[model samples]
Target: MALSTSNRAAPSSYLSLGEVAAELGITDRTVRNYVARGVLPAHRIKGSRLIRVRRSDVDALLQPVPVTDGGDAA
Candidate 1:
């Protein structure tokens, strides 16, 4: 008998909960809250609590708000 393996690699978009939290300067609990509130998308691995989020999805949520002229600038 011999062990077998493939050269396939994991998706680049997915990141750990801690990675997302650290990038946002927040805590894991806060990240979990965002997931719970439906503000962010997450997926938990089957048979375990390991959560992963798409980098694109997280980046979308962190996009900077556009500034508009209110005609009141001093």
Candidate 2:
């Protein structure tokens, strides 16, 4: 049977804390820190302590910063 569009879950990439830490070249604890600071969105399984971070949320943090014009330069 074909699944209904309304019943489909949104497409999203999720990574374990260790996986995210490896991808970012940081420690797992650091990933946890980001989650604690609300810098990254995360979720934990019911009755489990494991945390998962959304890949899109991590990508948002990697966005390039815009450069400013020299108009305000002394």
Candidate 3:
């Protein structure tokens, strides 16, 4: 018998608070604040009190900064 493969992508792994902070170049407290403010979504582990965030969620926080051209205005 041959195994069947699906065209679906694998699920993303969860990230710890520290990991999320490092990824965003921010402090863990900031990450916690984001979670508290409902800006970032977090999940609780099934059997533990530990909380985790998805990489996709972290990536979602990344937004392109608007660049302004240095020009003199009259």
Q: Which candidate is the best by TM-score?
A: 2
TM-score of each candidate structure, all chains considered together:
0.69, 0.70, 0.67
For candidate 2, list the clashing residue pairs, or say none.
Answer: none
Return the candidate ranking by TM-score, descending. 2, 1, 3
Query: Best by lDDT, which number?
Result: 1
Candidate 1 least-lDDT 10 residues: 1-10
Candidate 2 per-residue lDDT, tens place, 1-74, comes to 11112222333476778888998999988887887777777776445555666788778878987988869667
Candidate 1 is scored at a TM of 0.69
Q: Who is ahead in TM-score, 1 or 3? A: 1
lDDT (10s digit) by residue, model 1, range 1-74: 11122233326677787999998899999988888887888776555656788799789989998988899769
Please tell me which model should have the higher lDDT, number 2 or number 3: 3
Off by over 4 Å in 3: 1-12, 65-74
Candidate 3: C-alpha lDDT: 0.74
* Tens digit of per-residue lDDT, candidate 3, span 1-74: 11123333324576788999998999999988888888888776555656777788788889676889879877
